[model samples]
Target chain A: MRYELYYWPTIQGRGEYVRLALEEAEADYIDVARCRNGESKMMAMMNSRRLDTPPFAPPFLKTNKQIIAQVANILFYLGARHNLAPKPEAARLWVHQLQLTIADFVVEIHDTHHPLGSGLYYEDQKPAAKRRSEEFWDSRVPKFIGYFEGLIGHNKGHYVTGRRLTYVDLSLLQIVEGLRYAFPKRMKRFERKAPAIITLHDRVAARPNIRAYLESDRRIPFNEDGIFRHYSALDE
Target chain B: MRYELYYWPTIQGRGEYVRLALEEAEADYIDVARCRNGESKMMAMMNSRRLDTPPFAPPFLKTNKQIIAQVANILFYLGARHNLAPKPEAARLWVHQLQLTIADFVVEIHDTHHPLGSGLYYEDQKPAAKRRSEEFWDSRVPKFIGYFEGLIGHNKGHYVTGRRLTYVDLSLLQIVEGLRYAFPKRMKRFERKAPAIITLHDRVAARPNIRAYLESDRRIPFNEDGIFRHYSALDE
Candidate 1:
């Protein structure tokens, strides 16, 4: 079945996680918000009071009479259907757990530039952002990314969950790429401690389907409007 | 099967969500961290390198040789086994989607008190916390909580998913209670706009199992250390 993905057209944001899975699986899908009049359609569906299972936010996948929302939840659905996750229930839950941890990390990474509140401009919260960013790199980043590094070392495999590439690995690729773009100088130093994560990131990036998708125009460039933004002040 | 839940000893943090589900299901489980010598065991399990699937953090359930982390993931597992979720794949996904939304709301609420970073104490980030709390009460709270309110109104049932009480309903109860504890002044006014959510909260609270759990020592009191902390400064 062809899937319809609803998200902001301008930036990868959380939608990129879903996009990576669909691309990796070679699934037929449409990036709805990128299509002409698609944003309006997405808003209409979101605002539609008639929808029984209305999504709380975007990055929802619509297919077969169901609208699934939340990045991890969407990935969970796609992973089960597309052979991106393991067959065993226990192993599948483990991968989803890692994805949820990635979700938490994403929030922390975004807060580095918008600590005071998302409603406020980064310019308005620059001082607070700097302070938060300092804490993020000093404590949060290592705590989170290091956990994955340890997992990779322990698993002794190219992927997070053994040799198979699950959606978690796809997300880790996005995390590495996003961090590098958002905090080039800091990520340069951080990369030294997480060679395994970097290696996995490179592997996922070089995957034929993922490589094609990354180079395609459908892949939205990372921008300040997205979760991972390049701001020199916050980076340093 | 007896489930062993690993989480922090203090505070009704994320662990409480899992605790609620177990209570509602009347499932046999041990709050590992709360038991004697349990905290050390929890930390050992977390820091163990030999374990193939180590949890990034606590509030994980170990049962039938599977360790499930992430509150939504654990609830998804328990919901299926305990009849707390629907039978259909689409319906079950809808319930899980709502639980994931609740997870996001929890992060926002936690950040209202610790916006700069969780590493820094509330005392250190008081001004930033005030600014973040203002935006949270003004924009975030309404957007997240109101979505659930709207869903309840649209569902026109006793629960968020209609007719049957799902884990989402239990989480909504926790959100209402936590918000009331954390931001009494703001929530007093906010609750007026979310009467349906408040109603669902009360209904869930009045359930025999949940009420018993809330009254028992198993339910940790909301405190300064947990996700929902009452600081008069942040509340206003």
Candidate 2:
């Protein structure tokens, strides 16, 4: 069965987390909003009064009768369905818990460029953004990366959940990629402290499906429009 | 089984979400950080290198061998065991999806006062905080509350998932209370547009166990610190 994924057509944003998992599982899915006139369909679904649980925003997945939103929630559903999550109940919760932490980090990354709100332009919040990015690079990035590094070290296996390439690993790969793009110099310096996470990123990147997706047109380029924006002044 | 919850001693913060669920279920649990020498215990656990799955921060629940963190993860675990979540898997996921959205909103609430980063003081970021909070009060708050209002309208039952008092409902109660305390005048005016959410909050607050918790010392008072903060300048 083909799944329907609804999100903004251009940027990967939060939708990338779900896309990476689907690609890894080799699942049949259509990125609905990217198709011609597909965004209108997505909007109709979002604005539909008849639907019982309307999504607050895009990046919702339509499978059978259910429409699941939130990046972590979608990944959690896909993980269980595709065996991308752990088998044990406690382990499954742990995977979801890791994804939630990643979600929080993503928000902070987004706020580095848009500290005020998403509705405002990056130019409007550049002053606050500058201060925010400084703190992010100096403190937040290392804290988060160090936490993940600690996790990898604790696990007996290569991945977050010991030998399993769970959805959390896929999301972690995205985090590393996004950080490298947004703060290359900072990440270069920070990499030495987080060798485990860095190794995990390299490992995930080498996976055949992930490698193909990274090189293919399916992967969206990082831009100022997306969450991990590369503002030279802010990066410094 | 007695669950030990590790969180900040003073503020309700993110821990409050978990606290509400435990209180509602009338589960045997201790707010670990609030007990004598509890903050030291919490810090030690956070910095512990022994555990395979060490939590990144507090608001983690220790039940026997399992250490669960993240508000939604903790709630999901408790909900399943105590029958606070919906019976069906799909409904359970829907409740989780809603809670994640609320979690996003909470991040925004926290950022309103500390626009630069959590490392900085609210007073230090007052200028940016003023601008950020104005946008939150005017736009973000309405957008989130309005989305929930639409959900209540779309659903057949009174609660988020209908008929059952899920963990999402308890969190919603905390949201309303926190928002009311933080932005009294604005919430008073905003309440007219979100009658359904207001009603839901009232209903959750009136629950036997929840009512008792709110009236007792178990419920911490809202203060200058925490996710929702009241600043006269920011409010105006």
Candidate 3:
């Protein structure tokens, strides 16, 4: 069945994680919010009381009459359905744990630009953002990258878990791309300690379906409006 | 089988979420870090490569050789094992989605006092925290509580799902308690808009196991060291 993926139309935000998983599996799905009048539909669905499971925000997936939100939760559902995750319950939980950790990293990245509030502008919080970004690069980025690097080392596999490509690998690719786009100089310095992570990112990019999606119009460009905004002042 | 939970020994931080779930289920588990010499064991396990899946942070659960991390991921596992979650896949995913949303709110709460960085002191980021906390109370608290309020209205359930207490309900209770402790004035003002959510919190607290646990010595007192820190300036 074709899936309906709801999210903001323009930004390769958290919604992009769900996109990568679906694209990798070559699954039939509509980028619902990207289509004409889709934003209105998304807003309506989010505000509607008719749905038993109303989403708090965008990047929700509608499949089989069930609406699932949260990037990791959506990926968890699609991963199982599309064979993107391991079969065993334990392994799937591990992959999901990785996804949750990645989710934490993503939130931290977003806060670098919007430290004051998501409701506020970057210009309004420039000072705080600068300070926050300093700490982000100084500690958080390395800590997270090092953790993933450790995971790769522990697995002794081509991917995070093993040879097979799990949804976490796809997310890792997104994180690398987003970071490189948002903090090019910082990532260049940080990449030194994450050779395995970089390799994993490249390997995921080389996958046929992912490559096609990246090159095709399906992929959205990184911009200021997205989670990983490129703000020169915020980056050291 | 008995479970081993590794987390920070002192604070009722993220670990409390896992603890609440275990307590509600009356599951056989050890708060590994709280036990004698448990902190050392937790640290060794965190640094050890012997385990197939090493956790990046605490609040991890070990059972039958599988180490699961991330508060939501661990709860998802335990919810299924202990029959704490709904039976159907769609319902369970919905429960997880709710938990992820709660996790986001918890992060926001943590940042209210530590917006600059986790490594930095709340005092170092006091000004930023004031700004962040303002936005939190002004927009986020209302948005989140209202969302849960709407969920309750939609489900027409005593709990988040319907007539049954799930892990999400236990977490909601924690959020209420934490928020009340962190932002007493703000929560007092905000409670007017969230009657349903407040009622749900009360119901969860009134649960036999949870009531016992909260009154027992096992429930750690809320303090500045935890995620929901009490700062008078942040509340206003």
Candidate 4:
């Protein structure tokens, strides 16, 4: 079945996680918001009274059966269907748990640049942002990345779970890429301590489908409007 | 089989969501961190190298076979086994979706008083907290609460997912109670607009098991350290 993905057209944001999963699975899908009049269509679906399971926000995948939102939830569904996740229930839950941790990390990363409030402009919270960014780069990044590094080391696998590439690996790739783009100097230093994550990121990037997708126009460029932004002040 | 829950000993925080579900189901469990020397046990298990699937943080459930972390993930597992969720896959996914949304809302609610960084004390970020709290009460709360309100309106059921009381209902109860404790004045006015949520909160609180749980000492009192803190300045 062809899937319809609803998200902001301009930036990867959380939607990129879902996009990576879909692309890796070679699933037929449409990036709804990126198409002409697609943003309005996406909003209409969200605002529609007819939907029983209305999504709270975008990056929802509309399948033939139902609409799935939340990047982890969508990935959970796609993982089961596309063999991106393990067959065992316990293993799937574990992968999903890791994905959820990544979700938490994403929030922290996003807040580094908008600590005061997402509603406020980064310019309005520059000082606060700098402070938050400092804390983020110092403690939060290592804590999260170190946890993953340990997991990878213990798993004795090419990927997070095992030799197989789950959606969690896809998300890790996004995290590393986003971090590098948003904070190149800091990420360069940080990368030395997270060799497994870097290896996984490179591995995922080398996958033919993912490689093609990354080069494709469908992959929205990272920008200030997205979760991961390149602000020199915030980065340093 | 008895479940072993691992979380911080002092605060309700994310663990409360899991506790509510276990209570509602009348499931046999141990709050591992709350018992004698339990906190150290919890930490040791988390830092253990023997475990293949290590949780990134607390509020994890150690069942007979495997451990499940992430509040939403644990709830998803327990919800299925205990009938706290629907039988159908699509319906179950919808409930899980709502739970993930609640998880997101929880982060925002927690950040209202700790916007800069979780590591930094609220006193250190008081001004930023005030600014963030303003944005939270003004837009974030309304947007989140209003989404649930509309869902309740359309569902025309006693609970979030129709006639049956699901884990989402339990979480909504926690949200309302936390909001009332954290921002009494703001919630007092805000409650007028979210009649359904308030009603659902009361209904869940009145449930025999949940009522018992809330009244028990096992239910930790909301404090300054928890996610929902009643800081007078942050509240107003």
lDDT of 3 by residue, A1-236 (tens): 88999989999999999999999999999998889999999999987879888889989999877989999999999899898999788889999998999999999999999888899988899999999999999999989999989889988899998889999999999999999999998899888989999999999999999999999998999999999999888767
Predicted candidate 4 versus true structure: per-residue lDDT over B18-56, tens digit per residue = 999999999999999899999999999988998999888
DockQ of 4: 0.91
Docking quality level of the chain pair in candidate 2: high
Tens-digit lDDT track of model 2 for A1-236: 79999999899899999999999999999999999999999999988898887888989999987999999999988898898997688888889999999999999999999988877888898888999998988899888888888888888678988887999999999999998898887778878888899899999999999999999999989887787878788766
lDDT of 1 at B39: 96
TM-score of B-chain for each predicted structure, in order: 0.98, 0.98, 0.98, 0.99
Instruction: Write model 1 residue lDDT over B54-101, tens digit each, in one string.
Output: 998888999988889999999999999998999898888899889988
Give Cα-based local distance difference scores for all models: 0.92, 0.90, 0.91, 0.93
| TM-score for each of the candidates | 0.99, 0.98, 0.98, 0.99
Per-residue lDDT of model 4, residues A136-170, tens digit only = 98899999999999989998999998889899999
Clashing pairs in 3: none
Worst 10 residues of 1 chain B by lDDT: B227-236
The DockQ scores of all candidates, in the order shown, are 0.91, 0.88, 0.89, 0.91
Off by over 4 Å in 4: none
Q: What is the TM-score of chain B in candidate 1?
A: 0.98
Give the candidates in order of TM-score, highest first.
4, 1, 3, 2
Q: Which stretches of candidate 3 lie over 4 Å from their true place?
A: none
Output DockQ, candidate 1.
0.91
User: What is the per-residue lDDT of model 2 for residues B82-201, given as tens digits with 9 covering 90 to 100?
Assistant: 989976888888888899999999999998899899899988999998888889978999899888888887785789888878999899999999888888888888899999998999
